[model samples]
Target: MIDSGSTATRRISRTSLVVALALCLALAGCGDSVAPPSLPIGSHRAATHVVAPGETIYHIATEYGVSVGRLMAANGISDPRDLRVGQVLTIPGGDRGASIGTASSGVRRYTGARSSRQFQWPVQNGVVSSGFGIRNGAMHDGVDIAAPAGTPVYAADSGVVIFSGTLHGYGNTVIIRHDDDYATVYGHNERNLVSEGTRVARGQEISEIGRSGRTTGANLHFEVRRDNVAENPLAYLPDPASSDRISFAAAGGS
Candidate 1:
């Protein structure tokens, strides 16, 4: 009887062990086959993307709504036409499908999403008599247009008047602060029509052309500044070859 009881106990123990082992194996299989939750579409982390067959920088830039220059700047690329298959590239800046703009360190950000309006001529048919740059060992910060003293000066774009008074070396200046870190300056104005802190729309009258700041001739000195930093206004302005249009006014007469 004692032997039979011991055998029965051993058999039950073995059965329980087998059942536990089977249960553990089943749980392990379930865990292994479980699928992870998917991330939402267009939820991309900022990383390098591999170039596939038939891919070009222009096509990618167009598809992504990013500028080619910006893309190249972000990826440290010198040539846009020289892309290798399976090569890695970093996207510079993107909207990321969010209303808020991306904020990268050392990068300027513009929150307003308004379309750029057509700029008007500051002085009608005025020739750029002077160009921007060093003139006679002096830094000329804007272009000069030789217009009549009474010639009406129009606002380049719709913006608020930040300053409408005399400034050092830019006498009788009128500065308009526009969106996207843009600021237009009209210097050597004979008269300022709008006061500081007033808003003026594009093509609106803002000042009169004159030689006010120790200048030699009646002219309008205009400048377009980005983030208060000066750039070649000729690059951003309209092409002169297509039409008789002066897109921007450089530091000196052009």
Candidate 2:
């Protein structure tokens, strides 16, 4: 009986040891089963959550770790709550998309530089009465040359004639698309001497001055454009007072 009691005690001790080992293993696994704390997504990082049904802009912004103001400003959205259901809004620098504000600001500044490269005399002996900028609330995009009617207007540079005809406000207009992504428009013309697609040399006779385009007197409405956007002609062209020549009529002439 004594030997049997001792054997039973040893068996109990071994079972307790086994139970303790199993409990320790279970506890170690339970600690791992607890999920880790979520990390905060940055504004520039890629989005992790998609907008679900009934998700508010504030909720989306908070979920993505960005401010509502940032979302609106970056996307040019005036109203934060008015986002369309299917509109994919960028999370600031998310998606690696280009910033609209930065790109347009750079474009405006670069365009100012391009306007300074070349110039032309709208009329041979004309004086500039009005320069580009603002008239009332309307932005004046070109320079106004006060010359007598029938003053010969020469092509400002070598270009292919893109438009030559009468416009509603410009009267007889001639638009020339030149090389180096430059173009010039001669408006308020009494006569158009060039036709569409005609390749004209610099200083070639292209039109004659006239009082058109709701003008007060006979003058040449001259414009210089780059990539179709009108730039200030006065910024790029040389001063009309300095050059004694009437026109660039012989610039590209053989």
Candidate 3:
């Protein structure tokens, strides 16, 4: 038979042991890890994104609810196809509506007046990666047509080459003065085929597409100006749906 006092002591000791075990479990000292609770959706958004393999600018733009042109402008990206894996892109603030004008069927519509003069396509089988508009709080004076390097750039209309050479942001640029104070510009060319003061006809090859002057990939920056004021090229060129239209991906891609 055990002593009564000794029996009480053993019971106390057992109770103390159970309490210690409970404390250990509560403190998570037994190697059982717990996952962190996830935050609510839209609670937080990163200001920058690291590009991953096979990630296109269009995909990122859609994911962030921003326009492709805005995203490119924010990052100084002239060509969407130039996006590389591991590249860091700055995420611009505001939604798609703030960055781009009203879009229909994923293409931004130019609400401004169209040009009265008609013009032909500058690059055949090219993709219009960026359109003329206000982007990143600044006006993008031209449309960027993505094409393979060395692709021929044609004259939009019959005119005389006014300027042919490097000009600031435009590399190997060729400017043609057309009738009625209208002009066309072809920029970011591998080489200028026409010299200044040379006459060129409509559809004449003027330059070759290249990734020169503030660009990361091969493309042609085409612009239409009247009285030195910028105008939307889409308004002057043939509709992309027409048979004579320059092949383009309205959704922005290579």
Q: Name the best candidate (by lDDT).
A: 3
Give TM per candidate: 0.49, 0.51, 0.56
Supply candidate 1's per-residue lDDT for 207.
91
lDDT of 3 at 67: 39
Q: Model 3: number of clashes?
A: 0
Candidate 1 error regions (>4 Å): 1-119, 240-254
What's the TM for model 2?
Answer: 0.51
Question: Judged by TM-score relative to the true structure, which candidate is superior, 1 or 2?
Answer: 2
User: Per-residue lDDT of 191-239 in model 3, one digit per residue for the tens?
Assistant: 9999976889999999999977656578898877654544557778766
Clashes of 2: 3
Q: Please, what is the whole-model Cα lDDT of each candidate in the order they appear?
A: 0.52, 0.53, 0.61
Kindly report the root-mean-square deviation of model 3 from the true structure over all alpha carbons. 28.7
How would you encode candidate 2's per-residue C-alpha lDDT over 1-254 as one tens digit per residue? Answer: 11233656634533442332233223211000000002212224554344556876555543443433445555676555567676777775343222111111111111122233675655678655554432222234455666789999999878777678865566678877666556687878889999975888888999998876556678787767554434456556664344474332111100
